[model samples]
Target: MAALALRGFGRRCLLARLGPGPALHQTIPMATTAQEEMRRFWERNSRSGRPVSPHVSIYKWSLPMAMSISHRGTGVALSLGVSLFSVAALLLPESFPHYLAQVRALSLGPALLCSAKFLLALPLCYHSWNGVRHLAWDLGKGLRLPQVTQSGLLVLALTLLSSAALAAL
Candidate 1:
């Protein structure tokens, strides 16, 4: 017990010589909110001239990079389309047939109609095919550079063909 007391005294003396330091369990209250912290972090980073991400400005566009961007864009477009459609369905007073009839009344040209249909189908087809490619990547397949390029091309081809078929239908 005496030795332990001496050890504690020695530690106190050492600390006293060292002057005050942060406590092991010290809780420092935040002076800024998370938003302010983030703002400051961004400001610092911007001043340092560091890229915020793998920005397109720094890297030349590649097939894989484009495909990755398209995948995300299509996913977002599909989600927003569905969400807006659902909200419109809930809020709009008109029934489905009413809108259908109105569209028909427009008597849009066949080419325009087909183009619209293709646009609608394109995002779905691209997202689905790219998702399958991503699944293959998860399974440790089609991950090599050559294989990734091949798969991206295949996804594009399939998306175009499938979307065209749907548009024709």
Candidate 2:
């Protein structure tokens, strides 16, 4: 039944295009297949002489924009880390403490251990602080340009301080 209706609709469109006076003024909705839509898209873009993608490298980077991208990057990195850890936990024959023992057995220097801790904590701290900033945005606060820049700076400072503190431990 739906196919029949569509067929009838196509006939009406054909007749409308071929039919008499005032037909041009009266509009008929034309259904498009994906292929036709894509063909038209490429044709229009080619005629426009614009690049398919925007020239992101040419644009000046701003603090808020950098923070926004970093926020997403940290989120992805954190998620993947947790997922891999979970999978390792499930798949490894021995438990996490066994791995911890092995790592400790290396008798790594204090500075190296602290650096590793800092590296692990850095993303966590950044993501957490930025998350709070996003929550503030959701609450309709610190949305102004100056406020955004201030919040970004605050997030960076807090992330460094907290990560350093964690690394010290």
CA deviation > 4 Å runs, candidate 1: 1-58
Per-residue CA lDDT of model 2 for 1-169, tens digit only, reads 9999999999999887888667667778789888999999999999998677675545678998889999999999999999999999999999888999999999999999999999999999999999999999999999999999999999999999999999998
Residue 60, candidate 2: how far off, in angstroms? 1.1
| After superposition, candidate 2 runs with Cα above 4 Å error | 1-53
The model with the greatest TM-score is: 2
User: What is candidate 1's lDDT per residue for 80-114, written digit by digit as tens?
Assistant: 99999999999999988999999999999999999
Residue 163 displacement in candidate 1 (angstroms) = 0.5
Which 10-residue span in candidate 2 carries the lowest summed lDDT? 50-59
Hey, what RMSD does candidate 1 come out at? 11.0
lDDT of each: 0.94, 0.94
- TM-score of each model, in listed order: 0.67, 0.69
By summed lDDT, which 10 consecutive residues of candidate 1 come out lowest? 18-27
